[model samples]
Structure formats: C-alpha cells, structure tokens
Target: MTTPHNPLCPTHHGGRCPAPAPATLLFLHGMGATARSWDPVVRRLPATAHTLAYDQRGHGHSAFGRRPPTGLAQLGDDLARVLTHPSDCFPGPMVLVGHSAGGIAIMHCAATHPHLFGTRVTGAALISTTAGRLDPTCGLRAPAGPALARLFLHLTRSRTPVSSLLLHLMTTTRWPLYGRTAPRPTRRACSAMIRSTPPATLDALLRRLSTHDGPALTALTRVPVLIAVGADDRLTPRPHSRALAQLLPHAHLVEVAGAGHVLPLEAPDLLAHHLRRLLPPE
Candidate 1:
C-alpha cells in the first residue's frame, strides 16, 4: 500500500535554510502554485540569507480557509499572522517577495496592516501584479476574460472538478501560462499543485480578486519596492507592473524580454539578481 504524503512538508527542493540569520526573506506564490515554486529562485540567493517559502492557504499544503473567499484579504491575514508571531524565525526586518496573486496578498496586507508592515517589512517586490483592473484586462485575447473568470468562480463554488480542467490548460508549456523557455519541470510542478488544490479555494480567491483595488498601496509608498514583469506576459502584462511602480515612490521596474507570466521560473537568474539588490552585502 502507498503511504499518505504530508501536505505541510512541501516538496521544495534545495538544502534546508539555516536559522538565526541576519536577514529573513519571506516568499509568497500566486494562485495554483506552492512553496516549491520558489525552489529555483531561492537556490540562487546568497547562502547566508535565511528564507521561508510557505504554501499560502489553499494552494499547496495550506487549507482552503474557513472564511468566504472574496478576495486576498484572507491570505493577507495569513501573512500578517505569520510575520507578527513571536517566533525567532521572523524577528528583525523582513523582505517580502510576492508574485501574481501572492503579490496581491502582500499588497492587501501592507494596505490593511500598516503597523505590521511599518515595523517589520523593510523591502518588497511585487511581480506581474496590479492593484485593480485585472477583470477588465489581463486576459489572453479574451475581451470577456473577467466575466468568464467570474462564471467559472460561480461554477466551482465549493471543491469541484472545474479547477482540474483549468489546471490542465495551464500545465502545458505550449499554453500561454509560461514563457517560451520555461523548463518542463516548472510546468509539471504547477500541474501537480493545481491538481491537488480545491476548486473552492481558487474560485473564491479569483472572485474576490475581480474587485481588487490599491487603496492599500498607499501604505507602501515609503518601502523600497521592485516591480518585475514578463514583457510578453499575456496574463498580467507589463502595464500592470508599470502602474504599480507609479504608485510606489521608491519602486523600480524591470521587464524581462520574451518571458511570459511565469517570471520566477522562466527567468530565475534574472529574478534572483534583482532580489539580491534588496539585500545588503554578505
């Protein structure tokens, strides 16, 4: 008989991170992804940088959450809880790194929990994300992408099979979810995580994201920010990142050429280089 696997112990590759390091890095992933998604990116970081990349609620090891999945506020709460906890692992300043929906969660947390961000969050990186307007645009040539997304959310209110179909569409590298050079392993990893995720989790989050706005961004204007996006991304295009940069007075924008939505995996080295800039010399 096959043994059951533990969802909490995510399948992130690379050696374990050392504790009590001077700097702490918290990595958050987007929808349909897990902590393992940061494997390639984290491996490229400095050896001394302590990092924790956890599966956000409902994606990998995390649960679908008890609250209604209206928007990223719930996930933002999760981040706040972890960072504010009285744990040595989270002590000192933190560099927040988020991609896509993960970015949205970080933004929500920053916007809503100013005390947490002002005290602990020293730097942030928002990749391929927007404060709002996702529903109006950001689809793959689908003018009604937002409406279609809403329809899917309604169809898969609770744990359902609709997410599986959506997963399959995004699994293939040939699909627009990734860049042309994105490794097959990256695609495979995303497929596995999405297959295991509940439809309710994705549906609720996406539904809430439809109404996402950036009033919270007002809190992050003073924090150093990096806005990166794939030049060819059909999902959350460069325009969204550019708009976010404008909101952040200390934000810098970087556009990766020929890359698509999967910026972390497709351009790990480039992403790492940018992340390194956020840290002081070892």
Candidate 2:
C-alpha cells in the first residue's frame, strides 16, 4: 500500500528533493508530564524514523489551555489540531504512542475523528490508560480502599493542599519506578517534566477520567492497536489492560514484568522494542 505524500511536508517536494522517512511516530505523554517523558523510548528507536513529541495542554511548555475544563472533547480537538497542522504532522500516517492520561487523549481523538484513523493514523499504542470508571480501588488497601478512593475523589476538585500533597506523595512515594530506580538522567527528566505541570492540570485530568464515556473508545476498532501495561502497575492495574484487550481482539496486549506506572522511564528499551515492531520494515 502506497502512502500519499503529505504534500505540505517540506521533504515532499515533488521530484526535486528526496522525500523524508516513510514512517512517522508521535508520542503523547501522560498526565502531569511533558513530551520529554518519552525521550528514553524515542532515543532508542532508529534515527531514520520520523518522530515528534510535544507538550500537552497545561503540561510543561504547552499553555494552561484557556481554562480548566479541558476535558475529553477539548483534548480530542487538541489532538486533531496537532495532527493537521503542517508543522506538527509528518508526511505519512502516524503510529500514535500515548501514556496514562495521554492514552485517553489519543482515544478521545480517535473516537471523535474516526476518519483520521484511516487517513492519518496507522496504529496506536495505548499505555497505562483506562477507558472509563477510572476510580477503581485496585491498588489501595482492602478495608480502607473506599475511604481513600472517596478522599481522592473529593480532592480532584483542586483542593490545593490536599491535591498538592497527593501529587507530591504520588511522585515521590508511589511506584513511579518498579523493581529498581531508573537511571539518573531518566529520573531527572521525569522529575523536571512532571514538576513543571500545575496542580490544576491534575485536577482536570482526574475529573475527565472519572466521567469519560467508555463507548467512545469503540472508534479505535478501525485500526490496529496495542495495549501495554506494567505488570506491577498499581494505578491503572493490569486488569484494565486485559479488559481493553478483550474489547479489541485485533489489538495486542503486553505486560512488562517488574515495571510500574512509568514504563517509558522504567523500561525504555523494552518499551521501544515493542514500538519498533509496529513500524514498517525499512
């Protein structure tokens, strides 16, 4: 199958200059993270592949996005904007890689713009994401789970001190890295990207996740999909991945052992290995 040239892509100068790489990959970072979070995985890919990663709204370099309610609808629009812009998109259909909330963002885009799946996107990798009902008490302790989930829910409305404390705890105390600590550079990169995001971003993300429509994700059925998760993941537990896999049998599901919520940082090479498999042969 021949992919139509982007026409506007600089390298697509007809018969005048050599066209750019045939395959393009776009990376979307998770909530409270910048595009830099995918650096580890991106770096491991072959240099010839066209790759792009950018800060999501209110995270890192991107703006706070006019205001808070940047829910799935707005995020879906944002993804479409990035993909259609001449400067943002590559010359070929894209293999979309997204993590955590970023995964939902990709799904939202696919859900709303089904046409893009065939014309602009080749495949998608949904990493550490959930479709809906994200408030499952998967990782918390048995007896106190409901209370903690309720507390987390109440704090989702941007109760500053609690929200800040919860985020701080999540970053420092929770299982950001599993089995062992990530490399120094990876740790530093994750810290810088995550720390730069404001409290309101996290608040809006939780609210959206809580209310997202699961049926919307059916739009992804039009293309090949990959669902990858960490074996020891507590946040979006492995079962979530399993359920999503069942939803799309055409999709592949992979669980990286000894990994947690942050697979991009925890196992960059491993994650990149999976990504490379989806690429077209050179």
Candidate 3:
C-alpha cells in the first residue's frame, strides 16, 4: 500500500531523489490540549521533517459542530478524515505520535480501519496514555467528579474580564503533573490550552473516557511501536502504560523519571530522541 510520492515534499528532487522520502509525522494532542502543545517537540525534529498537527474536533481552532460525539469512534473517524483529507496533503508513509486521548483515538482508528494502518502507518508512539480503566475523576475525591469538572470547564470557556489572574491560577492548579516543577512559560501554555476547550466538548470526552473499553490494537502489532509514560504521572499513571505495553508485547516502553502527564511539554527532548528512532536514517 505505497502512497504516491508527494511532489511538494522537499526530498522530491524532480522525481530523482536517491532514497524514499521520510515518513510524515502526524501528531495528535490529548484532552484539553491544542496542536500548539507540540511546538517544543516538533522544533527538535530535523528542519526538513514533514509534520502535521491540528486541533481535534471541538478543540482549539476546531469547532464542536452540531452534535457532540458520544464515543471514541467519532474521534477515530475524525483522525481518518484528517489522514485522507486532500488539503492536508500527507501522501506518504506516516509515523503517528499521539499523547493521552490522542493515543486512544489512534488505537480506535487502527482497530476500526485496519486497512488504513496496514498501508500508510509505519510507526507510532503512544505517550502518557492508557488502554482502559481511565479514571476520569482525575484523582479528585469522591463527590467532586465529572460534574464539577464540567463546571470548572464552563467557567474557563472564556477569559474572565475581571480578575484574570485568579482564572489562570485556577486553571494552572488543575494541571496534572507530578512533583517536578515545569518552567513558568510551559505551565502557562498548558493552562491556556485547557482553558480554550469548550465545556460541552470536555464533558462529552470525559463521558466517553469513563465508558470506553480498550480498542482492539491487533492492527498495530505490524508496526514499530513506542510506549512512553511519566513515572510519576498521576492522570494516566505508569500502570496504565504497563497495561498498554502488555497488549503490544513488542513495544518499547520508556518510563521518564519524575515527569508527569505533560510529556510533550515536560520532556520534549526525550520524546524527540525516540521519535527520531522511528524515522529512516538520514
């Protein structure tokens, strides 16, 4: 299932290039995160690398649209569309890099559409994600669950006109990282990403997470897989990643010491190193 060469790719030198073009990297962000969250890691890739990152439905620049999707299928279907969408222009082998919910979406897509994975997807990295048993409570005590989380999301749907400081503080405090302190800018950026999500979208996603059984990932067994998790990640802790690795017995699992849920921002360098391993040698 070879994709036609993308003439516009930098490596396509008048159809006379000596080697096959590098796989285009497609990045998917987790819940409450925008494509912008990938900036740090994308920056670390080679200059000529082909990369694509976009806000998932109801996230960042993308809208929630008429009806909010009730299951992971919609998310997976959305990913399929992105891969095949003509305007996105990814006409070659791909390496999928998904964080958290993004990784879950990838699993659903691969399971539902094995044909697509068999052909174009050559590699994948599932980071800070889980296969099943996602605790949507997010470590909150009993009684302070999804409803309260939705309320918080509602409050942050828009920037507050008065006391914006307090709003930012509230958002930052909820960020699910471990003990190590993130740089001020990274913390602020992550907070802003979460704030951008509409409450409805967040609510729907939380519901989906709570009910979803793990997707059948047999299709992924054909590809090179890297499973990474923050050792101290509280949201989808290391045990979650261990379960995922057990399912994909051949996967390489890396536990980043002291890092947390925000692996893309928290440890971009380590991610960049592993992502390069999936790419063809230059």
Residue-by-residue lDDT tens digits, candidate 2, 28-82: 7888777667777877887666676667777766776568536756666777887
**lDDT values, one for every candidate:** 0.72, 0.71, 0.75
* Candidate structures ordered by TM-score, highest first: 2, 1, 3
Estimate the Cα RMSD of every predicted model relative to the unseen true structure. 4.5, 5.4, 6.3
Give candidate 1's TM-score.
0.84
What is the C-alpha local distance difference test score of candidate 2?
0.71
Pairwise TM-score winner, candidates 1 and 3: 1
Write one digit per residue (lDDT tens) for candidate 1, span 59-119. 6666555653556887887888777767633467778999888898898898779886656
**Which portions of model 3 show Cα errors greater than 4 Å?**
1-20, 136-170
Stretches of candidate 2 off by over 4 Å are 1-19, 87-89, 136-138, 157-162, 176-188
* lDDT at position 76, candidate 3: 81
**Candidate 3 lDDT by residue in tens digits, 54-138:** 7787777776667755666688888887676554345678888999999999998898888777578889999999888866556
| Candidate 3 TM-score over all chains jointly | 0.81
Q: Going through the candidates in order, what is the number of backbone clashes in each? A: 1, 0, 0
